[model samples]
Target: MADIDAIVDDLDAERADLEQVVAGLDATLWRAPTPAQGLTIADQIAHLNWTDELVMRAIRNPEAFADEFEGVLAPAHAVESISAGSAIVNAGTVERSKVPQSQLLTMWRRSAAELSGILRALPSGTRIPWFAPRPLSAAAMAASRVMETWAHGQDVFDALALTRPPTGRLVHVVRLGVRSRDFAYQLRGLEPPQEEFRVELRAPDGGTWNWGPADAPGKVEGSALHFALIATQRLHRDDSDLVARGEGPEEWLRIAQAYAGPVGRGRERQRPLDAV
Candidate 1:
């Protein structure tokens, strides 16, 4: 079984890394546009804060979370579409963006801390309600938070033209990416391959992280950082260093998504700095 406490600790570290980046930024920098269209660096943090609060509510009171989820889905129920749900989610970020950056940061820090506390105290095997197809265990939820913080932090870093060094905590994201392979295909209305694909990634500490059988017909190999970026839709596949050795693995790499939601509009291909 996964270690819930350790995952929550990594989630805390991920939040701290992002907090350090944004905490140093002035108001002007906070308003800078990110790769996510129409969303500023402030919006990124606001979105995180908003989601963290919602997740906290889900953990603390599942019934209330269900009511809110129903309200969010009500408008889209007629058409059976998630666009309305998406808009409702986006609206939270837009509304939260009105707060002063300093205040927003304070709110985010409080929410994040409270969330970690709640998760740490949560009983083992307890499932937390989510907007997902099913409830998630405390450990999965915490790991998702880690992936999200890292992904959104990437946008903030890109907006400020800064680079963050890879950390051991990224293993959570890599694991999520691998586990979501089938979901990624299913979400796109494509049938997932039956056979598992071998995944071999070079970790930040010069260790190889392996998943699946070594003799699997399909394989994906690359830097863990690049794989995480691709999975999170932070980096375009064209710009990544990953290699896919078979058709199934290749297709999966092209549309990998480690996040829960409708399909994401991933980053566009960029010219290399040297080429530019």
Candidate 2:
């Protein structure tokens, strides 16, 4: 498990970065289409707000979360299937969009703060239920929340053509990305490679961060930003400068997912950074 304090700090930093991105947008920019299909900048924020609330609710009251989750899934009965669950969850996002942008921003900020507080106070070994069949530890859940914020923040930044530079805060996301290799394989119903895999990333501050065993047969090396983007499914392997070695590392790099969700059809190879 990671240091919960460090993870919470990074979460705060990521949320602050996202807030900065949306700070000055007018109504038109708020309504502008983001990279996500048919989702606007406002919709992105709404989705975040809704998800933040959902996670908080899950942590505070499992029974309430179950009811709310089932209500969100009322349109579909197969919540066990990833796609069905995703659609149901998306319905909540769409429902959230009915709120005015100003109100949504306020709700997002409040929920984020409440989320941070809950995560900060949780016992290290606590397991919280989420979209995945298995619950996650406090540290893992916090890290996933940060990854979601960063991934969705990219959509907002890309929609506005704003350039968000990589920072040391990305270490949390990179770590989650590396650790999720097996989960990614499981999500796709493929056998996880039986070999150890190594990941080496160049942090924005010129420090090198490494994960997995040093002498592993599989390896991935690249800019931390690129790894994070690929892990979030915002960039394809071909679009990144990452060097992959061994079949395990290469395939893992191609379909990495740091966030818990159904397997996604990742971006096409050679997709431009701006297009992400």
Candidate 3:
């Protein structure tokens, strides 16, 4: 069984890591453009803050969340295409960007802390409504938060030309990446491969994280950080060191998506710093 407390703790840690990076930024740096086109560092935090607030609503009042979600999916606001969905999601971020940097930071910090507390108190087997096709257990929700924080934080780090050291907390993202393999295909209107793909990643702690059967014909192997990057759409497959041993795994790498949403316009391939 997934340990809810542990997941929540990791979520807290993930938020703290990003908060530390942004907490000291001045107004100019706060408005710095991230790799995500047209979104500033402030906008990224605003997006996280808004989503955290939404998750709290989902947990505290399912009916209200459902009502709001229905409005989001209403005919006038239906997400008919990738750009349409992105416009809906970015609308709040754009408005929130007008807030002063200090106030936005305070808002995100408060919401993140409150979210951790709420997730910690969730009853066992309780499921939370989300934008996805199905509800998620509290633990799954918390882990997804960690993935978002980390993925968005990467854009912040890159904007500042900094490298974030890999950590064991990445295991949450790796697991999510593996679990969402089929969803990645499904979101694109393609059938998932029937055969399971073996995935082996070298974790930051010098340990091998393995999933799938030993004799699986499709296999992906490489650094956990790279896999997580590709899965989150933070890095393109060609920009990573991952190796796919079969057509199934190879194609999966091209379109891997760990988060729920419209297919992401993933980062463009760029030469590694060392190679440049």
How close is each model in CA RMSD to the real structure?
2.8, 3.8, 2.9
Give the clashing residue pairs of candidate 3, or none: none
Q: lDDT, candidate 2, residue 134? A: 61
**Per-residue lDDT for 228-273 in model 3, tens only?**
9999999988889899999999999999988877787899979866
| Span of 10 residues, lowest total lDDT, candidate 2 | 71-80
Q: Ranking under lDDT, best-scoring first? A: 1, 3, 2
- Evaluate residue 83 in candidate 3 and report its C-alpha lDDT on the 0 to 100 scale: 35
Error of 2 at 206 (Å): 1.3
lDDT of 2 at 126: 78
lDDT of 2 by residue, 1-276 (tens): 478989889999999999987867898998899877778988888888888887887888877766756543332322244455577678989889889888888999999999999999987577776676466788888888888889989988888888999988888789888888887887777889887788889999998999889999889998999999999988878889899988778888887988767777766677756876
- TM-scores of the candidates are 0.93, 0.90, 0.93
Residue range 157-220, candidate 1, lDDT tens digits: 9998898999999999999999989878877878889999999999999999999999999999
Clashes of each: 0, 0, 0
